[model samples]
Target: MSFQGEQHPGVQAPTADSEGFRLNHTMLRIKDPEKALAFYTRVFGMRVLRRLDFEEMQFSLYFLARPEPGERIPEETGERTVWTFSQRGVLELTHNWGTEEQQDFAYHDGNAEPQGFGHICFSVPDLEAAQAWFDANNVTFVKRADQGKMKDVVFVKDADGYWIEVVQADRLGQMGD
Candidate 1:
């Protein structure tokens, strides 16, 4: 059956429920969009699915995805756009012109070490490969456990010094799923 909004030849269009009730993407402000793009792509193997620049608003946004082994992304970009890939979730990068004030600004103030901000996590196919990449890239870590009761988990920081947690995807799934 042919689908209305399915740009791809054989894919099915999103149904009505898919239109209304959908988890599209998550937007987060970063210090620099270009730097953030490099970090996410180089460290986690994500690709830029789409990018938009709002001249009036003086803002730039990037939608990224972790595609499968050999899948290609569709070419689509529009104002207030979204990017999707063959992955479990989405990551949105928003760059607003001027210092708009940090949403978690208070987390860095009056706190001994900004411990509450937690970390951004990416499940790696291999823990060793992930660790090596982090090491080679000189990404600092809040904590590193050789091996504990929990699966191999390492806490690292991103370009803006935001904490990021790295763990094996399969190991985590085995514990929960």
Candidate 2:
């Protein structure tokens, strides 16, 4: 009961070398490529950095990321491919062919019981504006900006019912100020 300082069981602390590694991307499986692509691009302002289609495997991979304002994805195939891989925090959406045809096909969103993955986050310049946009566009909100216990935070869902954490970048550094 009188534990002053201790290292937890089976726990390892990060070292300076860990800083050299960066998380490249996280993936989500989708049922329909068209539906997924439209939702991400229209609602989130993301672009298809690169897309790989596997006919034999009956699936496709689409790498999506929000490009900087006024930024254009290079026209050259090689340039765009390389540019896509270089960026960090990209979202990779996989679409298995024929999923939309099945009557009861669905991907586990990792939000139900025995949860493993919760959600992906996006930081915006203005939380209120983003929330308003979502509301105006009829985007599904798992947790609204005003309804949540935590103030100034929003959680919205995509076409596939995946939760996306939204925060205000300007207010980020000013949290609790």
Candidate 3:
């Protein structure tokens, strides 16, 4: 059942025309952009690469990514926007106007019953240090690395209760079924 080399049925190979296609970003709706931005930037070390506002629609989008060491981000807005969209693995947070002011407003985290979308993951160099950092930050943990049957993987919740899975790439290959 290993899918490493074998292609699954009904899957088509990439065509030459799609060679440059890349996943630019994943968008998530947030009730409060300020809180969300703080959590992501402080906890995850992601930088706001670009931001766009739709005044008529009463919503704003914030694009974020973890830049490499010594990476140069374009200073000009036009160039930055283009660079932001061209990069792979970006996170986009969409904030609707007035949701933060609503007392009972909440977005479905997709981890409850009838779940659809799942969590996003981050790979860390040192899993133990990351776990300790999350603990120091008072992060709400769905499961600690040592708690569950599936060891060496941690899940923590964000300000909006969306699940975020944390893992170490080297440890992942050491796991057994």
TM-score of each: 0.67, 0.83, 0.94
Q: Give the local distance difference test score of model 1.
A: 0.67
Better of 2 and 3 by lDDT: 3
After superposition of all CA atoms, the RMSD between model 3 and the true structure is 2.6
Report the Cα lDDT for candidate 2. 0.85
Q: Which ten residues in a row have the lowest lDDT in candidate 2?
A: 168-177
Q: Model 1 TM-score?
A: 0.67
**lDDT by residue (tens digit), candidate 1, 1-177:** 764563657877567776646565666667666667888899878887777789999898777767788765555554224335333457777777654355543213111354454555677778888788888987776666475555578877666666667878666656642
Extract clashing residue pairs from model 2: none
Best by lDDT: 3
Compared with the true structure, what per-residue lDDT tens digits does model 3 show for residues 82-171?
999999889999999999999999999999988988999999999999999998988899999999799999999998999999999999
- Higher-TM-score candidate of 2 and 3: 3
Segments of candidate 1 deviating more than 4 angstroms? 1-20, 76-88, 99-117, 147-151, 173-177
lDDT of 3: 0.93
